[model samples]
Target: MMLRTIKRLSSRPVHILGLSTYNYSHNSTLSYRKLTTSASSQTIKREEQAETATVKKEEPDEEKPKLSTMLNLDRAQMEKDRLARLKRKKSDDSHVPQAKHIKTLATQTLTFKKEESVDPLPEPSTSRRGPFMTLRDLQERVASYVPRHTQYLDGVVKKTYVEGRERTPNDIKLEEVFQKDTLQTAVLSAYVWEFLWVLQKLNVGECDLVLVLHAKEDEMVHHYRRNLCNIPRTRLCFPNMSGNVNCMHSKLQLLFHLTYLRVVVPTANMTPYDWGEALGTGRSEGVMENSVFIIDFPELPKTSATPDSNPSHTHFSRQLLHFCKAKGLPADIIEKLDKVYDFSRSKPLGFVYSIGGSHHGTEALKNGVCGLATAVRDLGLKTKKPMEVDYVTSSIGSLNKEFLLRMFRALHGDDGKISVQGIPKKYSSRQLAEPAAAADESTESESEEEDQSDNKLWQDIRSSVRVYFPSRRTVAASKGGIQNGGTICFQRKWFNSSTFPQSLLHDCQSVRRGMLMHNKALLT
Candidate 1:
């Protein structure tokens, strides 16, 4: 026992929980030793108290001002204020029922205010980014900078003309332009107001409105009802659909009555808009597009020929009539197209279409573009500075080198001077600058020997290819918004063979320059 005690004295003594190692003070030791409550909380409180004491000793003492003293107020008045606050808080607790009643009344009154006066609605979907900006913010403020596209949706709805831009949507005043005895009209569009508004403005009291079957048709119709001053006597046409994937993407205003047919193809769901309107500040105006209002009437030939003289040379009006008939159009309109309109004489151009989404992928480019190309070739017009064919559009598709090769081939053929220029409103400004440098390099790199290869036509077409890109503004002073520059490129080259009758949809990685384009038109 004596030896063990000696050993214990010589060696180090071990405290429970290694408290001696921590060098805990007496207060800390007591706080941790308490078993009735959590040691952690007690220790924390002790530490806090010690820190607060230290802080108090270190702080300099100055004359602290009371709320009343700071404002040069009297103590009695400050006391009264404190008492009033307490009284107000006590009253608040007692009058809870009345306060609730007042809140309910306030809510009811607020319901009467116009909704637009309220905060803007939450974004419809987090997934969707805003439509692509085509210009830099700074460029938008440049009064003289020409835009590739114009923002004319406001004009379309207001039916007012904005200066320094394209003609108004109702520039010709369709109501005044067309003769009496209104035509049997067939309108294709996604927006009902765009369709109905134009029809009403044209004095079309009765007509057919064609819609691509969509899930939100019910809501859209409800909204359209609010837009219209009078409910139009409309015959709605939803083309026969086998699946949800396909839609009637074509936008056309086909009117026929009493030996005449007129076709108006506008971009953006036939919204009454000006094709030549100047792009405003901070709007998409990087590129230009082509558009036209097509009007044609059946002309009787001096030589006698039946309405269906040759299926090959069937007039544009007749072809339109055929398209309607194939779709099982309403009997009344069909009757008018069949009897009233003559289809003997040929027009300068006709509308071409693809039946399904797959059709756009294949036949649309071929038939539509190639047909135009063939027509251009037939024109035999000579120009020293290659003929400039333009495409102004809103929609683009996945285009690739091969598809472009095919297209250029179809358009250019042996004609070296044919240069195709496209300006999609979304990428107008940035793409405008692309063609100059890229085209020169690309054209220089290719060899003429390749002309003898299988893709001779494509090679020839690539020779004269050029695209346009515009200068983007960096910032906008008026809106304080960052508008991004535009870009263009194609993804796939699914098209291998050039088909006749091209449906020209703009597509490219290298974009082109344009001035206030966006009306869907093919101008040769």
Candidate 2:
């Protein structure tokens, strides 16, 4: 039983072993399957984690583009808003001030418009007479009437032939005493006749009184006989002396007595003293003063004359301040006179007087007229009186209606109206033409040419005067020195007496030099 059992056991054992092996194989297979499943599950988990990481990295890039676009839009919107605000601010600021200015302008315009709309107009008068009358009418109503013509003596009235006078031992011999006197009388008479002839041509009337102021003794006596006594003796008044002090006094006294209008004959050595003497003595106390006018005759220095020789003897300017001081004239009067009597203002009048007075030196004539005008203006202002001033030319024969008409036209005519091209049709014909026009044109042209020539005459005169009168060296020494090495000299070639037609030296050198120096110092 044992043996059999052993054998069966062995076989059974083999079978059991085989079954165990099979079971082992099955277990291995199952284990392998589980491991494979576990491995696959791990791999799937790793894949899922990698995919998640990649998706996270990719998500930032995608979001970055979207954010950049949104940011750009936001920035554009912000810039637009800022621009809009600035534009609104600028518009507000510009509108505010402009609106205010426009409103103010509109208000001003409206005010002016209303003012113009409400203004009133006056009614015209029905009177037949015109509002403005001529100056002549007023003069006639106010002026005193006097005889048109008066007789005057022809020559010096000698005491020998007086009504009842007999020849006396005191009278000098006729031949010895009267030889020069007679010749002078004759020459003066001729001059007077020529002057009267010229006056007749000018158509002067007899009502006008001829005043001789500051004339030389000989000239005064001569003119008195020839012109004053011969044509209209009653219409003449002699101041009796050549000095300014006497002349002024005579003028004033005559004005009060005759009640006649007189014209002044300004000559060399006539000063403000003469003017004041003649004009200042009128109507002080309940007295009817005469109407007097001034006819300025300015004389220039002689060609041979010098500033150092003394202009006081020949020029009335030196007496101006002295007269003012004596008369106690105000400073304002002096200042006004200086300004109004400037050369530029007095040139036209000065030219007339210079030519009439036969003044040769252009500068002297200009200076004299300027000084006289200044003195007259000052005197008038101080006295509160307006004196009529007329420029009388030696060429003008007389003071007539036609002469006055011509003068008025000449003074008031437009610029260039008196020229040759401006002659009127009526005046173009010889019969109806103004006789004086041609002469006046010639004279004017000559005067213009003379001005150019005479411009240096005064400078030459001053130089000559300085050289001739060395006494003025001290005056010049203080002001550095004289020009041209202290040798002041003038040439005769520069002098033109025909065109100028005036005497520069009427008296001695001492008088002339003193007068010139006095005037120079004062002017300087």
Candidate 3:
């Protein structure tokens, strides 16, 4: 029984070893399969993660450009809003009441005083039997009355004899020569009185007259008026020794109404040719040998002067005395004269004559203007109220219009129809008309060029665009939101479905081209 048990135990050992080996092989196969499966799953997961990371990186690149575009649009919108606000503020400020005072002052009229005195002169009866006087008649009247002797020629007499009196058995003096003293007396007695009558008829009250004299024979008339009319001479004289004086005259008719008078005199040694050129071409036509005159009316009072209790007769006498001393005249002459008549209290009607006065330079002209202004001011002060001063520099064209206007405003308070309102309107109209006329010419040219260019550009752009109709399938696909389609398919299905007329296409192209060109021009 021992031998048989040993044999069975050895066989059982062999069986147990075989079973252990089989179990080990099964466990090894299961572990190898699990390792391979796990490695494959990990590799798949890594590939998927890398693909997702790549997609995310590419998405930001596309979104970055879109973000930049959005930012630019926001900035443009903000700038537009800022400009709009500024425009609104400017518009609001313009409506405020600040320019109204200037407007009111610019439209005020000038004020003048009423005349108080009248001379007991006989009025002339109107006669309609005579024809109107011609230029020849005026020439004849001037030649017959004015003396041949002139101060300008230093007392030289120029004569023209009548026809057929050149040679004779006994040569007779054809031209008549009168003594200076006799001529002066005659002018003072007859011509001056007539001139004064003309002045008195105008009713200009207590104004100064400017008499321009050039040692010409015509100046004798002015001298006679000055000596006989008893007008006082102002201390101021023109720089050029032109025979001219500014006499105080009260009325316009007295100074400007004479058709035969030579009102303006040039003392600057200018010939007729030179004078013609200086004045302007074509101005010398029909100019006769006549004298020039300016009737400068005194300024009305802006504010009244305080009258002295004693009327300061001493000051008045002293001023007269000084004037006499300066002119080297005897003060007793004034004393011997009778006080003919006093119009306004302490204010005498006077005249000034400038013999060879030349207001050429800036300083001389300024002084002339200032002297006139002061004279007007003194008259205004006498009245004790605000007044207007009218400045008529010369009836002749020798005076500068701009300079005269400036002088007028400087003397007056720039408050009158002639000063602030009337003059500015005339000047502004001239200033505005020039630019407006020029702009009209340029605008017409530019508008025509722009229209032609726009038409050409529109024709070119219209030729480049292509359009077509879409199929039913493409339309159905687009309606289903299908993404797989060409741009042509989408455009044909939606945009080209509607037939655009030739007129409409042309208009759209034209508008687009015009808008593009306009924007480009503005940017440039």
Candidate 1, residue 158: how far the Cα is off, in Å = 21
Report how far off residue 301 is in candidate 3 (Å): 30
Question: Residue-wise lDDT of candidate 2 within 50-152, one digit each (tens)?
Answer: 4322323211221222222212223234334434543553454443232243235446745743444211111112222221323553344335322222101
| Candidate 2 RMSD computed on C-alpha atoms after optimal superposition onto the true structure | 51.3
lDDT of 1 by residue, 158-275 (tens): 2222223344344332332232223445554442223423443432332334433222355644544443323234545555444453455555555543334555554433333332
Give model 1 RMSD, 1 decimal: 26.4
- The best candidate by lDDT is 1
For each predicted model, how many residue pairs clash, with residues at least 3 apart or on different chains? 50, 37, 44
1 or 2: which has the higher lDDT? 1
Score every model by TM-score: 0.42, 0.16, 0.19
In order, the Cα lDDT scores of the candidates are: 0.36, 0.26, 0.25
The digit string of per-residue lDDT tens for model 3 on 394-439 reads 1212222244343433344222222212233334323234365654
Model 1 ranges off by over 4 Å: 1-196, 199-232, 240-247, 257-259, 272-290, 298-315, 326-328, 344-350, 357-390, 412-458, 467-515, 522-524
Candidate 3 TM-score to native: 0.19
Error of 1 at 265 (Å): 2.7
TM-score of 2: 0.16
Angstrom error at residue 95, model 1? 46
Query: Which runs in model 3 stand beyond 4 Å of their true positions?
Result: 1-332, 335-344, 348-367, 380-394, 413-524
